[model samples]
Target: MAGVRQNTSIPIPAIIRYDETDKNIIGHEFSLLEKAPGKSIDQIYHTLSVEVRTKMVHQMTDYLIELHAHPWDGYVGGLTPTNGEVTPGPPIDENFGQLPDLEKYWAGSESLESLNPIPSQGFAGFVAFTVGCLDHYIYLCILLAWFHLLRPLPSPECKGRRHERP
Candidate 1:
């Protein structure tokens, strides 16, 4: 968010304070940001005239152009604040937090950080890293599917059978 604010004219709310660790009083990482000065887009979008909507779209396009014009230094990963400067970190996945028992599905002995470290070889390395992660994920999925398929079917009469399809 801070990087976006620094790089673009996008109207991001000012982050008053933030904590990346769960040791704070809140017991979880959180950011406190000043409220951005605008009504919800959903509330006003339907009420907007075609001309107004078109203008809004154009403005959004300009913002996107500004963002793209100022690309990060070719590291394909999330940004973290280090000593008040934004630094590259591991690629963030929505499933990292949301998926239950995610570690069980990981395919290799390598940790996520080891598997997808910040590529020292810049954009080309980032591309290779992305492809490698995708391949690993695909392999894990296929392995899990095969494991399920190869498991013995439960006998209907045997309630204690452990291999029943859920």
Candidate 2:
């Protein structure tokens, strides 16, 4: 993982953990991996310029292609060489056929109601106040413009004119 860089063939959020009970034994639910260093591709993207960013993107695509071509039989369940759950050998979709329960998922939709029953009158009042403030601002601007126009100044060159001295 020392050589791994931004947008390299590596999984995001390197760790995912879950809490469990005695029935679960708590020991088997981990995917310990060869740790990669530095920040994610997102961090790199923010710092890179437009031209460099395009090249970085192309490099990432190439990395993906290489990873896909070479099957990963090297590391099994754990990072260490000896003690790791032997992976089920080669590719097979893990969660392919199992259909997800839609009802349990949709149950969270009820929370959207809290965002409703909004204060319409308060919003209308805010809009009206804003309009009033805008009108006052416009009036002030017009008054200022008129005063500026009316105020007189002597000609820059004082050309072709005589001023009376008191």
Candidate 3:
């Protein structure tokens, strides 16, 4: 959330010690990043020309290959969030299915419930429900692909990113 009064300034991290009180004058919490330098990769990608981007992501691919080749523990010891790292939780509950999909992580209740049309109620109710579920999943995939390809995607703020293309 830091901003500059002028554009020419480069941002640099500051080191803080246990005895130092940074928030006293700077008015914010500070952490000393030992070796990490933070920059928005998304914004960096947005600034490149098409040709430059192809070459850049090619280099990125090599970097990723190097990363993937690095020796992992080669075992799933199931480390956890308590260690400040992500780990899968237990098998999700039935209601977890009712929760939003990845595409709708920040979606509003009204937006989600809008996906719920009344299922047909009759002897064919089971068939109708199955077909409805399939159709909903397919529709979601199509919507997600379209959003990723043609735009930055709809957050909770831009759920209206649903512009149909021919």
Candidate 4:
């Protein structure tokens, strides 16, 4: 947020205080920001005239253009606060937290470094990593399909009999 505020003309609430560690009184990381002025776009969008909406859209596009024009380190990851500086960090996968049981399927789920391919390896390396991940998922899908297809089904007429795939 600080980096974005520093680099772009976008309006953002100023951070009053923030804690990234669980040592705080709340026992969870949190940030307090100044209340931004103005009604949310969703709240007043319907009430806005077409001309107003078009002007708002143009303003938003200008902000986006400013953001895109801002310089960034060439890396495929999210910005994380490291030693009081915002730096490129491993991309967070929200699914890992949402589905705890699926964590086992992903190797090195506990280690962020292991999850992210080194940025120094360049675009080719990233492409290879992506292809490898796709291949792994495709293999899992095929294995699951085969498991369902090969499983024995109970016979309708006989209570103790099972029907096998011929």
TM-score, one value per model:
0.60, 0.28, 0.26, 0.55
What overall lDDT, based on C-alpha atoms, would model 1 receive against the true structure? 0.64
Point to the candidate with the largest lDDT.
1
lDDT of 4: 0.60
Task: Give lDDT tens digits, candidate 4, residues 85-140.
Answer: 76665444443322232344444444433333333232233465476456545644
Per-residue alpha-carbon lDDT of model 1 for 1-166, expressed as tens digits? Answer: 8878876789888889987556678765578999878798999999999999999999999988887677676555566677988776555444432112234445455344443333423334556767856865675565457667667666789778665357
lDDT of 2 by residue, 11-51 (tens): 44443333211224553323445556776777677788899
Distance (Å) between predicted and true CA of 152, model 4? 29
lDDT of model 4 at residue 71?
64
Expressed as tens digits, the lDDT of each residue in 126-166 for candidate 3 is: 45545656665675566557455755544787576775655
State how far residue 45 of model 2 sits from its true place (Å).
2.1
TM-score of model 1 vs. true structure: 0.60
- Residue range with the least summed lDDT across 10 consecutive positions in model 4: 93-102
Top TM-score hit: 1
Candidate 4 TM-score, C-alpha based: 0.55
Clashing pairs in 2: none
Prediction 3 global C-alpha lDDT: 0.41
TM-score between model 3 and native: 0.26
Mind sharing the TM-score for model 2? 0.28
